[model samples]
Target: MQKVASKRWKLAEKIPPEIEQALSYYPAFFRQVLYNRGITSTEQAMAFLSPGEDFHDPMMLLNMAGVVERLLYAIDHHEPIAVYGDYDVDGVSATALLVETIQLLGGNVTAYIPNRFEEGYGLNIEALGHLREQGIRLVLTVDCGIRSLQEAEHARQIGLDLIISDHHHPLDEIPPANFVICPKQNGDEYPEKNLAGVGVAYKIAQALLRQRRKELPREGFGLDLVALGTVADVVPLTGENRLLVRAGLKELRRGGRTGLRSLAQAARLNLGALSTSDIGFGLAPRLNAAGRLESALASYQLLLERDIQQIGMLVQHLDDQNRERQKITTEMQKRAEELIQEEGFEEILFAFDESFNPGVVGLVAGKLTESYYRPAVVGHINGEYVRASCRSIPAFHITQALDACADLMVHHGGHALAAGFTIHRDRLAELKQRLAKIAFEQLGDLDLRPVLRADVEIPLGELHPEFLKYLYLLEPTGMDNPEVFFVSRNVRTSNARAIGADGKHLKFLVTDGWITYDAVAFRQGHWMEAGLPKEVDILYRFEMNTFNGRESLQLNVVDIKPAGGD
Candidate 1:
């Protein structure tokens, strides 16, 4: 029901006639899309479309040889190894993969996921002591431990061999783990640096499996966990990450993983028709709920569990927890908006709640950043120290910004747009001032307006059943590699109806003289009150809709404006 205003619709460059003639396999609109995405050549297009035969070599990763050697020795000797992981979905999937892969190779391993509320993120001294008490001779961390410089040293002093495999941005000082296997630390020309925790774990799995056998077992064996982590982490869905998801989706559709099958059933998802969106929207959140509300070990166990009744119970718990997570986030968002207003709407927003769930702080920050188009810092107001989640727009690198003020924080790690840290409550104001100054220096002069980039401007008639098939070629779309967008002009709306609870969405029948199409606009129910103008220009994604076993084309309208507006 909320209509966005002041959005900038940027159209893709027009393709020349000669180029279009040569790219007959590509629809004219999609040709521009490929070009915009840096796929200007036929070979580039071919490679993007068909990622076949090869993936990046695991040995090419930094310290991979060391990781493999250390891990192989642990496996052969049957040393008790603790798989340390964070609490998010990326960490959950990576933990599951590492545990299963180690078990498959006849290794002694146990999963150790820190509680979000208790242990917080990454390695802690208390956990190390407990692991040592449990006779953990070696610690293999997935998706975390990159920034645990102190804890890594403590593990060494306590006579535990530590191997860290994480994908987060490294601080200036790397942890003293036995071998840190992250590509970014190499400073070499690796093909892809955007592998999520699970992707990194998958590479380790591939190397271990190939080391143990002559030929690889299967094309995409056990990739469902990899895909779930890759997609859920919101990593760039290009390069090697694309290959992983593309293969993983096939495995997911096969219904081979009992836990995933039970989860899909609980979420009312059809594995046969599973897409990346299903994983992102339905499955990932539930998997993430285990970490956000409770121990991530629950989700980790769900991934490896084969018993039907246990899986059913886990799925039910995850579903319920996900619902509770949603409710908590909604209330937090409301409080965050109020905090924004109280702060007088500064350049960088700071929001905190004494009662806010520390786990959903990132979600709140993400929502606030998207809603206001500014960097948001959402903190869980602990008594003296606070755990804060920061989300930023494309213009600012949040982790880099955190690096600028690293001296003030207990610890921090993340990527460009999202990061987290712990700081004392007393320094909150100074932290705000420091970050605000940096944001002003970097982004104050910019437009700060949200822009929707379109692949091409095409008539509504161009979208047909055939076009959906072409769109199928671009699967597993997410961050970095986005879904296609179209700018359709002179669209006439025949009728408009407000749908959803309390009329929060707009359903319309639109035509551009040549084609009449069904359209759905999310959060635009306000348009129905004005009866929708006779003519308009709409920015939308051409979507294939299915209902009652029938397929048809519909426009998923993103933004609408007057027909002649700039």
Candidate 2:
């Protein structure tokens, strides 16, 4: 893990007196965290703390006017419209959101989510042909079609109009669509650029609302779908994204959608108190597991259905698929580890197996990259080609590197952090060599260690329900605006014991000079036998733990290090 530089508290430098006074209710350390994250001015602090405000104008997004005009035309003309989306949680939720939005507007609409294994990502030619045959006049793509230059061209050839509302990084040449609403597109003027796929779809929904002069739905009912996809896609939760998720989470807690309620029940989540962590870890995974292990249609159906019985059945199927996905992901991770060990990859790691499922390769590759903090690629070998998922550390841009080696790839596009590509199976070795060389050259002198950024340093005595409540102001935390992690130094573990079913969790009591606290570290059970020292530095987040009808405070350990060591 990366070692963060220690610094004195600097809240006074950033926070205004009024904001600081308002935060006086919180512990000094919690106030410092709020200040450090730029919630310093009165308005900024208030907005961050409240989260109900800070919405962006839907018209601010690029192509909102064009998209709205076209959609209105389609509604007025009674044209058959199709919503094309990708298959992940973000894509499925985006599809559900757009389909429902258009249906509410009285437009004849159908939805399409590409099959991961059969059709791959983006616009598939066969699917487009099928849609054309179904007399779909306008194609509005959600979460995909940004890179489908040829597919879009084919649609144009067939006299079908297309509009793209995607968040993926665009290639050098964009497809000729009727309208495009990607923030990252060159020359676009959207203020919040780093939107998730669902975020873009939500913008489209917002545009429709404005066109009709409709009141923003009560408590943002549409936001529940937005929250699921925004969190699931792991987009940075800052700016407009934070606002959308905050509202969406509120809707989710109130049980806005029956489909979401059914899904939460299937996942055994307590909806009343659901947090971003629960959605990202529990619900999103089950939704995504269907796309990985089986058909994504199940997940889409679960989200779009109104029938409680059908929702229950679909949730059960997804639950089973999630279990199977876990098993396959574990097996794939083991095999990837073995391949890394056998091949002795030093600066980069790449693995391929014909039997590996393409849908799960990305998950496995991500795990491998996290395990080693190296750029890793996991691919599924086919007859003459290989499709792979590439995950990189913050220091490397995998997609740009793939772009550099475009000569060897069939097609590739993604963000700087994660990407996907296809290459001739015969040239897999060459592709790996080229990518490794690029990564090594670019990241040679960089510190590859992962840094755990502590929001603030806190004395154990300062932890309380009030402080925890202040921390709740940073709701819907992900990517950029993450849950605050505080570092406590020179603390001693009073007692430690292995807990949980498989003894894979560690529950411990820690004490500083003036305070004692309960702490739990999941997947750190092996540390129990490592012998706790008298003094250690621990990185942790404050959480409200409920057990047996009782509520108490707990420290969720993120990392631990020797007190005086680097």
Residue pairs with colliding backbones in model 2 are 2-450
- Which tens-of-lDDT digit does each residue in 55-124 have in candidate 2? 6777887778989999999998999999998999999999999998888888999988887788888898
Question: How many residue pairs clash in all the candidates, one count each?
Answer: 0, 1
Model 1 lDDT, full chain set: 0.86
lDDT at 503, model 1:
99
Tens digit per residue, CA lDDT, model 1, 146-170: 8889999999999888999988878
Q: Quote the RMSD, in angstroms, for model 2.
A: 3.3
Q: Compared to the true structure, candidate 1 yields what TM-score?
A: 0.96
Question: Against the correct fold, how does model 2 do in TM-score?
Answer: 0.93
